[model samples]
Target: MQLTIERIYTKTVDHDGYRILVDRHWPRGISKVNAALDDWAKAIAPTTELRQWFNHIKDRFPEFQTRYLQELEQNPETPAFVTEVAKQLQTTNVILLYGAKDQEHNQAVVLLQYLQRQPAIQALLRKE
Candidate 1:
């Protein structure tokens, strides 16, 4: 599966495959029409409280990643999302779009890592 993470604010959109916005809140200054998204997987995003607590603080990134992974594990929508992504990967690339400025520390990064470790995704990767 070809999986990639991209900032929503980037001028160019990758139309090669499914573009999923993984943010709970709409990105500021961006309109829906311009997002070029196939799906907005808001259910997979961090809770409001967790987002607020993290606040993109670099110092808290380690803990934030731990908490975010825990949240994903407990989220009811995660299994479905993972299944959907795995299915999508069978045919095309999956672009995980996020609004975070920090490229390395956002929920999308965590989610991608989490998805990579899943058996379904791993099996899909082996086929390529």
Candidate 2:
């Protein structure tokens, strides 16, 4: 299933079946009620070390992906969880909400890329 990015401040979509947050740290100003997220996949977010290392640096993307993938591979639950989230997208659009100011380079983007690469995930997304 395709993963779309959305800002936390934006209105929640009625068709958005499952709104999943892919950020490690919660947004500074938003409250839980305002988030409107169905699932907070914090477990899949990058480790503190990786988060600190990347820090949204554009040139460090190659290094970031390498380290992020390492984290994903080690976390057995992440792949399955992401695959399931992809499946959920089939029935309803999954809004991958994130709080990062730099939209281009963020954990959500990396997480979205990994989810889209799954064969089963693509199939599920295609049906929708």
Candidate 3:
């Protein structure tokens, strides 16, 4: 259950476990083959409308986080993704990969925080 967030473009891809892309859209200029990804959980990403509104504006990050969490709460795919990640954690580390340039303000960061706070996810991590 060692979860970490990483930029998709980073040179380090040596991690020996799940490397899931959590972005709604594929990163520009990166090919599927080059991504070295195990999964692309786009359903957990921010909606197109929300992404457009936030536009990575640093000033809007706080509000964006709140809004995104609300979206996640209602998103049916979130639970399934969390279950899947928890199951995977039984055996290996999990990387929630993202394409955002803002390391601290991306959806992956928020999603990671949300997941870490969940009791189910916490139990799984504790087992590891």
Candidate 4:
């Protein structure tokens, strides 16, 4: 099992799968109708405070990771939210779509790691 975040212009592979949008705000230029997204899982995205803090200074990635993890920890809804995505990943390739210019440091990267670490994701990987 694998998860990837791609820009709106990235080519879509021919596969049975789901593409989940991981951004809280609509991406600056992409229109909703043109996105062809399967679901918008905003719960996995960072809170507004976290986003603002990260965007405030690009030099604080490590700190952002810690704070984001903490924020996610207090959120009881994460497991179900992630599990919902995992269940879909099992049956199809999962693509996480994000709009951040700095794709490397955005919430999508954190979420990709978090989702991969899930026990369900581990089990699925072991089977492959």
Candidate 5:
């Protein structure tokens, strides 16, 4: 699967294929009409408590990644999300859209890595 990450607020508007927002809460100053999102996978986003604790602190990223991975594995929506993404990937490139300014430490980055490692996702990637 050709998965990529992009900040939601970027000025560039020419996103190709399916774009899914991976944020739990709607990002500030963005409207539904302009976001051009195909889906919002909020179920897999970090919990409110975790998000508040992390507070975008770069130092907390490591622990946050671990905790987030655990949450992804335990989350009921993960399997179905994987399946849906796999289905979509067969037809288009999947863009993981996020609102975080820190491209390196945000959930989208972690999620892209995590998705790359998933057996189901990996199997599809191998086909290419």
Candidate 6:
């Protein structure tokens, strides 16, 4: 699947295939209409408890990534969500949008990596 991650604040464009806000909460200052989102995969995001514990601290990112991955593995919706994203990528680019200012240290980054590591997704990528 062709997947990418970007800040939700970035300007929308025609080429942002299936824009999905991967955040658990709506970003501040962005209107729903302006988001131009095809989906808001809140169920797949980190749990509120986990989010509060990490608090976006840079030093906590590694631990956060591990914890988030565990969360994803345990989350009942993740498999279905991943399948849906893969299906969408067959025809369009799937952008995983997030609100975090630190691009390298957000949940979206971890999620993207997790998606890429999946054998099914990797096979899909090889086909394209």
RMSD of each: 0.8, 2.1, 1.1, 2.0, 1.1, 1.3
Candidate 2 accuracy as lDDT: 0.79
In model 1, the runs with Cα more than 4 Å from the true position are none
lDDT of 5 by residue, 1-128 (tens): 48889999999854687899999999999999889999999998999999999999999999999999999999999999988888988988899999999989999999999999988788888888
TM per prediction: 0.97, 0.87, 0.94, 0.87, 0.95, 0.94
How many clashes in each structure?
A: 0, 0, 0, 0, 0, 0
Candidate 3 error regions (>4 Å) = none
Candidate 2 regions with alpha-carbon error over 4 angstroms: 11-15
Model 4, TM vs. native: 0.87
Ranking by TM-score: 1, 5, 3, 6, 4, 2
State which candidate has the highest TM-score. 1
For residue 92, model 4's alpha carbon misses the true position, in angstroms, by 0.1
Q: Give me the candidate number with maximum lDDT.
A: 1
Q: Could you give me the TM-score of model 2 versus the true structure?
A: 0.87
- Model 2 residue 60 CA deviation (Å) reads 1.4
Candidate 1 at 25: error in angstroms? 0.2
Worst window of 10 by summed lDDT in candidate 1:
10-19
Q: lDDT per residue, candidate 4, 1-128, as tens digits?
A: 65666755555632446888888888776777778888887877889988987893668888888888887778887888778777877777788888877768777777788877888877775676
Q: Mind giving the per-residue lDDT tens digits that candidate 2 earns over 1-128? A: 34577767666543346888888789888898778778888888899999998988889988998899889989977867867686687677777888888777887777778877878777776775
lDDT of 2 at 119: 81
Each prediction's whole-model lDDT (CA): 0.94, 0.79, 0.90, 0.77, 0.91, 0.90
